[model samples]
Structure formats: structure tokens, C-alpha cells
Target: MRKVILLFAVSMALSAGVRSAEELSVDLMQSIEDTNKSLSSNIALSNKQAATADAKELTQMFAQVETFFDHKGDAKNAVDLARQSKELSTDIVGFVAVNNFESATTAATTLSRTCRTCHTFYKKE
Candidate 1:
């Protein structure tokens, strides 16, 4: 009876450990999805005629990307990738603010590539 009880407790603890790892992976995936959405929205806004529209959407999307990094645990590589992405976004916003559509478009393209690289490295199959 003692051995059986001990085995059951160990099994439960192992299952919980697996579940926590799975949960962390899920959270990371969700953060990636949110970043993708923000990137797409920024791209669309870049093509808009109104500078105000572009500025507003770009600011909001960049904010969303930044928020994803807040309170993120010690995932150093992931954090670095996100920081690169945010830097590109900052450049894009600056270009758009100056009405430099060409530069903004180039920055956006680079930002997309950064996002893809990060996803490939960190996200699971």
C-alpha cells in the first residue's frame, strides 16, 4: 500500500510538470500570433492615403508588439528577436511620421523577415 501511494504521487507530479511546459509553449505561440497580427495591420496602414490613418494604426500596432515583451520570462533569445522586430517597427513609425512612404515600406519588409526568423527558431511544430 505504501509503495502504490508513492508511485501515484510521483505520476501526478510528472504529469503536472509536463502540463506546465505545454502551457509555456502555448503562451509563446499566442504571443507570436499577436505579433503577426500587428505586423499585418501596420503593413496595411502603410498603404493608406491619409498620413493620420497610417500614424494611428502604426502607433497602435507597435504598442501591441511592445506589450508582448512586458513581463516575459527569461527567454533571452526570444526577447532579442522581439527587440529587433520592435526596432524595425520604430523606424517604420518614424518614417511614416515624416511622410517617407518608401523608407517605411522598406522597414516594414525587414520587420516581416525578423518576425519569420523568430517564429522559425522559437515556435514548435
Candidate 2:
């Protein structure tokens, strides 16, 4: 009975990890959407502080995604793109801090492209 219980517990833990991993993609996408919305809105309004905050949030989300990839042992494939995404996000924040919406918009485009490139390899339907 003890052996059976141990096996069941391990199975349950593994199942939970799989479920959480599946959910992580959805959460990451939502975070990206939020960042885009905030970035566009703040830029249009020339709200430097808000745009900077959004960019910072995006950087954090990308870091989380990187950690997730590492956990899945897919970091070898995604590390560069993930790093680029985070760097572009930081660039966006820096541009916004200087009230350079044009540069920030360009950085945002690069960041979006990096995310798409990474998704092409890893995102499951």
C-alpha cells in the first residue's frame, strides 16, 4: 500500500507540473497582450512613466518565459530569442524614459518579431 501511494503521489505531481506548463503559455501570451496595449496607449498619450512601467513589466514576463523554457530543457533553442526579447523590452523602456516614442515603437516591433520567432518553434496549438 505504501508503495502504491508513493507511486500515485509521484504521478499526481507530474500531472500537476504538466498542467502548469500548459497554462504558462497562455499566461505568457496574455502578458504580452497587456504589454502591447499599455505600450500603445501610453505612447499615444505621450505618457512616459506608464510606458516605462509597461516595458519593465514586459521584461519581467519575458524573463519568466525564459525560465520556463529552461525548465523544459528547450533553452538551447530559445535562449537567444528570449534574450533579444528581454533586451528589446529594456530598450523600449529606455526610449520611453527619454520620451522617444518613435524609437520605442521600433524597439517594440523588434520585440514582437523576436517573440514570434520563438513561438514558431515552441508554441503548440
Candidate 3:
């Protein structure tokens, strides 16, 4: 009985870990898309405050992406891309904070490119 109880506990723990990992991946991807939309809309409307907020969210999301890829043992190139994208997001945040739409737009473009490049290698069709 004790052995069976132990096995059940271990199984539950493992399942919970798997579920949380899957949820994290889904949440991160959704967050990235949402952040992009928010940033684009805010920039187009010249809403510096909202754009800054969006940039901040993207920056954090990219960091999470980097960590997720690293933990998944993804290719080194993909991990590097994630890290580069995170850096670009930070730049976007800074640019938006200063109301520098031009620089922010450029950085955001680079961020998208990095994401596309990584996705090309790893994302499912």
C-alpha cells in the first residue's frame, strides 16, 4: 500500500511538471503575439505610454522564450536568436520610453526577424 501510494505521488508530480511546462510554452507564445499587436497599435497611435508598456512586456516575454528554448535543449543558434531578440526588446522599451518611435520601430523589426529566423528552424508548421 505504501509503495503504491508513493508511486501515485511521484506520478502526479511528474504530470504536474509536464503540464506546467506545456502551459508555459503556450502562454509565452500567446504573450509574444499579444505584445507585438499592442506595441504596433500603440506606436501607430503615437501613444508613448502604452507603447512603453508593450515594450516592457515583450522584453520579459523574450527572456522567458530564451530560457524555455535553453531548457528544451534547442539548437545553439535558436537560443542565441532568442537572446538577441530579448536584447532588442530591451532596446525597444528604452526607445519607447524616450518617445523615439523611429528607433523603437527599427528595433521591433529586428526583433520580429529574429523570431522568424528561430521559428523557421523550430516551430511546427
Q: What is the C-alpha RMSD of each candidate to the true structure, in Å?
A: 5.8, 2.5, 2.6
Candidates arranged by lDDT, highest first: 2, 3, 1
Evaluate model 3: give its TM-score.
Answer: 0.79
| Clash count list over all predictions | 0, 0, 0
Off by over 4 Å in 1: 1-74
Per-residue lDDT tens digits of candidate 2, residues 56-120?
Answer: 88888878877877776746778667777888888988888878899888888777778778779
Candidate 2 stretches with Cα past 4 Å from truth are 1-9, 18-25
* Per-residue lDDT of model 3, residues 1-29, tens digit only: 99999999999999999877644476678
Across 4-89, the per-residue lDDT of candidate 1 in tens digits comes to: 99999999999998776434445545655565566556555664445334434544544544455444555566667666765666
Candidate 3 residue 109 C-alpha distance from true site, Å? 1.6
Ranking by TM-score: 2, 3, 1
- Local distance difference test values of all predictions, in order: 0.61, 0.81, 0.80
Q: What value does the lDDT take at residue 120 in candidate 1?
A: 89
Query: Which residue pairs clash within candidate 1?
Result: none
Instruction: State in Å the error of residue 51, model 2.
Output: 0.3
Q: Provide the TM-score for each candidate, comma-separated.
A: 0.52, 0.81, 0.79
